[model samples]
Target: MDTQATSAPAADVTSLPPVEVDDAEAALVEHYPRLVRIAYLTLSARLGRHRRVLLAHRVAQRSLPRGRRVPEVVEAGTDPAYAVVRLATLRGALARADRVDGWRRWARSAGNAVPVPPRVIGLRLFPRAGGSEELALDRALARLDAPARAAFALRGVEGLDEESTARLLASAGVAAPRRAVRDAAMSGVNASLLVSGEFDPCVLQARPTDLVRRRQHVRAGVGAALAVVVAAALLGVPGSDGGTEASGPPGSAQAALAQALDPASLLRADATAWQRADRLDFASWPARGDRTGDQALLGRALSAWGRPGASVHVSATAGTPSTPPAAPPRLLFAGDVDGAAIVLLYDGVRLVRYAEPLDGGSGTALDFARVDGALGASASAVVLARSDGNASYLTAPWISGVSLRDLLSPSAAPQAIHRAADGVTDPVPSAQAATDANCGTAGATWPAIRLTPRAGVPGLAPFVLTDLGDLAPAHLTYATGRGAVPAEATSADATAAWAHSACRLASVRGEGVRTVNTWAFADQPLPDGAGTAQWLCTRADDWSGDDHVLVQFLPPGSAPDTPAAVSASARSTAACGPLQPGVLSGVLWKARDGRWYLLGAGSPEVASLTATGGPRSTSPTRTLVVPARQTTQAELTGRLTTGGTLDALK
Candidate 1:
């Protein structure tokens, strides 16, 4: 368990599988070391800095063994680093760092408690160079002070961001206010002398056997840097000859690093493809890690294990049946969900652990599955997402009809449930495919509808809805769209907002704020235009007084007769008309059977209707590829039809 392996990509194994999934994995295993070697070489050749020396050490150790391979590194020119940050395991790596917590923690423990490797100890990855030798950059970079070296390297060599540079520097105890210290670093720093003088001493100390090679490598590196920098200052780097190294001069080594690592570099690399000075050479995306397979198994299993409607929601005060006579009532369980992961709690049959995807993949090895409740024989069953910020409750058994909104106050108590994938707000769709026809895109998977209600809204707070597919991602709209939502029927005072899946009140300031008071009731301020309340007739919908609330659209695809008012029966008509007695009074919630049940109690005519259309085919939805044993397509489709919109987020 080396520290490098503990929390890096190699250990994180799940995600929306990329194209050629198996090939990607195999390629990574086969070519990762070569990729690392190339990066180390290119960077060392230019800046000759060893700031990621520790990282280099880890990289070398992580190489695949004989007959095995590592994933190839995906070269992202400037912004390649940006994609890496999305990965949980990178832990502030200069490049793509996805979910690596498990590996990181494991690496730390392994490095600390385990014995060192035997002779020829290996990470086992092969370098890409024709010679196939590990790039000896560690020796090349060690000559300079950590800050000056990191500044020059991150900015010019590795091409990392200032913030990332600062982070790495800070971690290494080298403070330079991000890239600010670069100004003071470029003197005739004399790369050759430093490598020989400094690297010579360090190599002898760490790997005495490699002295001859270290000496040769360090000399070649320094000599190269001398040529590049001196040439830049004299003839000047191709881009500029503006002023001092401190000023905006392209010749400066510092400027080069900033240019190299800028997250946008890859995005703009093509603009300079033909130019030697500006062209970049690397793959423009995040690379796959070694543990991707495992990540998937664990992610999907926990989601099923913690069936929101099936599991019972219990409060801490709600003790279980099994508490010993003297002990506080606690619960436990050990039954498996048909070979799917089962988290048991002890109400002596009382509390149970509910699982959710932890590292973004599927698995049932009993590894990475988390659940709420106490530990014991129940330990295997209960994986606690600790309450870190405000005291929050973990889902004990995922009680029926309860939306997470009622259970969580995110901004206020974010850290409470420490182990959920992302958080309570990130809705994981049910495996059920409730409807009849193929509801989503032509073959692409779209997830179960996920609707989320606002956190503190009055009556509607407990239930808000949206197809998560509607998340507003800038460049990926087509890929992200779940549906299109029109504005909600707004009263003069309240600014109502309706996305296809959810609706909320956007409080406005000043005079307009005085209009829709939540207290009073009025009918048809649009007086002449009246028959009954319609979700469509925004004008006649609101009551006359300060509080002018009306039935907005019933369900996204419901009929005109399906009055906005919950009381009016689900109107199904071609004209899209309002049904009689169009006045629904409250919020929506799901029932035990999975059908979306409304809560407005006032009118008898109000009825739950099965609307014809599904979620607007706009916002991209999330889809699950459930393994045959865990759930059948029929079972999943059945779970989806229960709600008005098939929204699981709510």
Candidate 2:
């Protein structure tokens, strides 16, 4: 638009001046040299080195407006001139490229057709001394598909931050570009050593996030619990439809269901249903002949409902066309209620039958696309929504006649989900077979994986979080929250130690093939709060997924009105109690009687402690299980392992 040939230094373009199109264009023109280098290196592998220089020039100039009017920059934080020109360039190149992957593009030309090793891509962009390694790197870059090549070039080569690279690639029309950038960067870095001949790039282990789709549903549901905590405590719980079933195309039943319910409205309806209905049917089954078939179990679930100030409202855009299901498509509804968040499922006509209150405590988030994709291949779709509180996760399907209570219970593993019968596998058959075969004696369980450096472990690459438009790196950010990773945490032994120290009870669950490790924290009393203790639970896995606090518990009779104090030392001490040894203390408080009390969740083997009259060691003089509400403590003489925290009961 601004064709005025004026010379000036290049503007950073990080923050372009609005309404100053002429100046912006001039700045971009001045920066063309730098832009060309970026473009050439970024696109060369995909378009082949021969055409890279020409394509780069075209991409830069074409990014400029062809018409008289300059277009407004649609995306925030992007330079209007440069971003437009770069995006245009990418589009033009893609049009000409052969055999480009729609989702992950690559070059199809004979010379650049092989799968490139990521290390080679890195070296090409950031050329170290040219040698066999450089040649190898060139070969690798040539072989990579377009998306991976672009990712490596931008983040790995250009050294752009993930956010910047994702934005640039996304502007160029890549699906899940943010995810792709992260993978490419990590893979590139990991592959750097492979060129040394000591390591094989193919043998490199897959990052957990790499192999599995981040459990967006479960991740989001963690915060969903806080929304429903109050109402859920009083009432009860329960638990997607979209495109198609994995079996083939969408069947009549699946299509009818997707059409029957508006995704957002249906979710709102289900949330409201939990509050209003004293006795309601599970979502898996419609009102068949006017009798609520699962009345008895449904009643137990409903008992947790009926509290004031409960709200799980779906935004207008919720369940919009962002994620389209196929074959036997399932519907997903995720929102916050009361103060917590909840995810509900719809099998067309009814809600998911589980009927348990879904709650993810504070700081919960969801990725709907990942949830849909994980279940995309399953015949009977299973939704992984958080149960009331964060202590447990429910991986049950929305099928009629299925008992959620039994399925969720350890003894009655649902037939559909038991063993390898029904679980997530790679969309690619070969990849799926690799995972299945690896899950033999070495595999801990469906959800429990033993992280090892061995070659045979299933490759766990991070899948794209399609629904996470801007928060694609959320998983990485969460991982750094607690503090630095200790040296011991480098291996499985350290991770297991961390778990046993912090959680009295821990388990793993498989959602569409991705494994998430869940843990329950001991109930610990708030500082200076004699009557109440706190219960906190979390979930995480190796690779990128970080520990998310699933539930935050405040015990009954505790100082509910008072805000909690920051007790870093107390929390650290309780996580792995020196006095308690292997026993993790949930909460600790000193009673007015000068005796200290500790609370915990689950069934823990607590060693006995004895104290008698006149402060002399004697036969157990006093011992009591810390009740939810207690202001007085006479003495400490008994082994105490509290049965339930506020969330554990849920």
Candidate 3:
């Protein structure tokens, strides 16, 4: 608020003469820009590491009345020095590391006291020495984001005052508090020394003076961890309501944003509209983004849809907002895979859009408001199985057809829309036909999209719903609207072919309206030609309505246990070693135990637990039969198909 005539040169502000006017209207200013700059540098240094630290440094007048250097900077006479004199001890530890990531991973693991998420570097205090000292710093300096580390190294490691530090690093508004700066330096120095194999500088070693603070190492990163176990394994980190996120980083709101959605992995391949998540607070379920019941499931699928190599970009601003924007809402995110970038937009949480690259690689922008309006018709409502959308997405009073999970059938590879009794003719009619009450597929008004693109598939042109209008493109960053596409069961021939294959596809549930009429139990007791059988009284067609199946599995030479317990985890683990080499290695199954178990072991990077498989896969044996068991329930209780499997890389 310097109320005087503005001057472009930094010299003018830096050379202000001492002048004060207490008058009410006497042109006045507080130099908030400089102060903010001070704060940004202070904090950025505090939250050390060279990654995209959100600090922005702006040149300012250096007329600080109380002139003194802040604690984070390294003084020339500091012990264990060099450019950063107070850290010679840190040099010793670096010699031992084989791979930086291994050490880093251990340092940031959940079990560690203060989860130092590899970013937020904290405090450091160096011992004094004569004029020249060698500060053996944690050379892993390569890891710290350039902005953050520079801010910290200059201020904390270079002995510059906050303003000088701010100017030095170039981003100003994000300065951290003096104490926090000290903490960050200490954290950095501690980590450096520990990793360097010196005196584990973090242990406080009696402090030898009135140096830093009292108890606490919240975000236990290696830097913090060194501070912790080195000094009581610093405790729990304060997360976003959990940990103190570096008092906001050192860049402009725009820069932090750029940093946040900086990478491609965060977005869909070349998506103009990518998705972004400001933070992962949802895993903790903060009250603001409530999204109850099915809404929650929708939220989960949408959020995880982005793939590392996805062309569409995605991002989100994690704030105090209550509910997230509706589907097809344009968003921004950490780039598709790298880190965070600012330009991209995405539908952050619910879906991943795949689009052909725009020329020069700007993603195709979607008109989100228009699209949101279209999806609006089915918000929290049940959608008919055959709702229409070809050119433009169909909008009307309806129920969302199905969960994304049900979209993909082997025959229905890209989609999970099961064959409705009436085919694509009347979704509402088919859903209503089941209960006979015509209550409209219960919430099918618009919320339940029985079929949408698989959580991460991509494309823009209309393919399915020939009955709808063409979807108009939105100007928003991401795909704005979705035109209705026909479910694979567009006709009887297609539906029948897919359904027949799904039905005949063995003991493991494949696709379609299939119910378990009976299950042929393998590995369990078998009498004559009959193996232990867990038969479902329900037939494949029972999937349409009140159909239920009976299931009983018996071991090959043993008597059937009155009740059996199968753990998807155990089965998955066994399948890796025990079930492999068999022809059925690739068969997919929804275990009676409730876990969706897949038959084959995939790539080494992913293939391990048998009970747990990727969301989709193929089955080797399709024909399976067993003596029918007489039971009322379609599936046993406590049964779950390791329902939440990781999405495949493709």
How does each model score on lDDT? 0.25, 0.32, 0.24
**C-alpha lDDT (0 to 100) for residue 548 of candidate 1:** 19
Candidate 1 segments whose C-alpha is farther than 4 A from its true place: 1-147, 150-343, 346-650
Model 2 segments more than 4 A misplaced: 1-35, 38-312, 315-650
Error of 1 at 338 (Å): 5.1
User: Which is the winner by lDDT between candidate 1 and candidate 2?
Assistant: 2
Winner of 1 and 2 under TM-score: 2
lDDT per residue (tens digit) for residues 296-414 in model 3: 33332233221112333433111111122222333222111111111212332222222222133555321111111112111111111122221112111122243221111212333
**TM-scores, in order shown?**
0.18, 0.23, 0.19
Better of 1 and 3 by TM-score: 3
Better by lDDT, candidate 3 or 2: 2
Clashes of each: 122, 77, 230
Candidates ranked, most accurate by lDDT first: 2, 1, 3
